[model samples]
Target: MNNLGFFKNPTQITYGMGAANQLREIIDAQGFKNVLIITDGGIVKTGLIDQLTRQLDGIHYAIFDETKPNPTVTNCDDAMLALKQINADVVVAMGGGSSIDVAKAVCLLATNGGSIAGYEGIDTCSNDLLPLVAIPTTAGTASEVTTFTVITDEERQYKLTVGGIRLAPKWALVDPLVTKSLPSHITASTGLDALVHALESYTSKMATPISKTLAREAIRKISSHLRQAVYNGDNMVARDNMLMGSLLAGLAFNNTRLGNCHALSHPVSAIYGVPHGVANSVLIPHVMEFNSLAVPELFSDIAEDMGENLESLTLMDRAVAAVDAVKKLSKDIGIPTTFAEFKVDDSQIDRMAKDAMLSGNIAANPRITTYEDVVALYRKSIGGALVEVV
Candidate 1:
């Protein structure tokens, strides 16, 4: 129905259990020497790092396993220094979102000759980054397949989204088995994170028929499989479904972009050190309730997809039901109900709201929101925020 459009996905993706074992072959195909592997300390403890090293043994790699949970510009700088010291020609991201983000920033800075901050808004970088391969250990934060990276600035106390197509990995290896060992809390949190991605993408202003298709399917998969996956870590079927859900949600948001939920969630994560998915879970339902009127049909569609009854319910009721479904899911998975539970203070609301407004995700919100909206949302999302919002 539309004439003009553009789609940008540069990563060559390989997804499955045991897929990471092909690292040597993937690296050989890329034809690069002197690679840098980026990951977090937790992954280093998981023995996957040893497997990765074994697969690519004697293949010229320097490990920089310091990608903190909320990766910062300082983290990237440190990784960059390490990469430069070793003269790495390729970057291998070997963990979840934080590791992938660090690798992306380092890869760009290696050739671009500047800090990660220099490439903040959009496709401002003209140079291509070093060939990078992403191995995601979590079923959430599909950072491996997307062009966006969130980096916190400690001095400024703001989480900024650094985006550019050049930041997309040259290859993405999504192996479900890597996620099997994640704790139940982590599985639940990341599963909710994937749900937020799907919901946000579905409600984004950039939503197209194609993106909606992916988003709806992602939502279905997460809703169906998340509880089982969280409860039974050994269930390969549940893990696989969660991974697929995460990947499809990544595909949807990568193209359609996200909205105000992500906008508000980023500040919470960056400032209070809340887990990324937990933060998103806290804000998503609030933002959804706020924006429900702006896009009722989309929300209604989501309600139907979540198996909520809409036969007698009005559009507003359906939207409310959708919000309730998200809240229920969060509760079932043991996600804390509010910012106060995360030890965030009431006085910090203004600072959080101010920073949230600066997130690029706000631009894609279906409804226009200002600082006031963000503040009110934060206020409503403190201890026991869910009941208050509903």
Candidate 2:
């Protein structure tokens, strides 16, 4: 790091107990026309979309509620078509990352006039996307605050990113109340995902002092609140803190990209159809273990942030405890510790490893990563027939 460090979070975040209800006022203030509310069917069934529409007394809006997990370019096309059908000028994404990612791509395609595949790399688009207002119903993903959107490209068998300041949501309405109805498993997985964000950003080679501070606090809050939030979803304090923690993590990683866990998990989820957070949950402990060699003291700090006590242990032992702490958290939250539970096909390892190394995230990892390192990590994460990476 030099005397000058960079920290950027472009989204205007409005967080409170009832922050989601302010959507109508924001839309009206902006004079946005024909709002397109993008979300998954689950959120539609939750009646959240209705709740949103009820607040918009006379706003013309349409709902595209077919966003799938690890949203694809196809989903973006569908959403763009829906936006075109209504000629919507603004978009309101009111679900997890999938819906928000689809909306971001739609915004890009609406203005840029190209397939989402063309804008796969960082800062690849020149034009500004459509006006976007993100309301995150889950504590994880934090797409509401991030400048990156991961869209699965089925043809490539990869999770493609369209990232830049232009992709950031104009506003993030983070209402903990919107998260009160989340099922326990979702609360767990999403919260765990937030933890991984903080962990990776905290130790990222690109981390700045500002990102580290936010990541550290995020780790502390998530470690303390996630278990309670998962087991007792109705607890408002736990929900609120989890949401806040997730927001902080998003803001942190928005500047400093995540490490091997995110890099590795993308291919796992794309290949096996495992949920993003669950795949990350299984890979995080291993990533921590691998990264500990590069920054042992940082790992120790992570352990302390996660509420683990070193109690006069060796320096290396303290670092190892960080990996242990992550594993314990996953087990306690019912996240699978291995890929076997997901029926991951080991024969896919070579292709997956190649794809994993292709991630831009690998450059930000604290450790010097090689294609061979990614192959080994996959073998360790997926303990099966383990065809040698050719």
Global lDDT of each candidate: 0.86, 0.90
Displacement of the residue 65 alpha carbon in candidate 2, Å: 0.4
Clashes of 2: 0
The residue pairs found clashing in candidate 1 are none
TM-score of each: 0.95, 0.98
Off by over 4 Å in 2: 1-4
Best by TM-score: 2
Best candidate, lDDT-wise?
A: 2
lDDT of 1 by residue, 269-356 (tens): 8788998999988888889989998998888888888888789998888888898888988999999877766788776777777788
Put down candidate 2 lDDT per residue, 203-315, tens digits, no spaces. 99889888999999999999999999999999999999999999999999999999999999999888788998899998898788899999999999998898888998988
Least lDDT summed over 10 consecutive residues: which range in candidate 2?
1-10
Cα lDDT, model 2, residue 247: 95
lDDT (Cα, 0-100) at 113 in candidate 2: 80
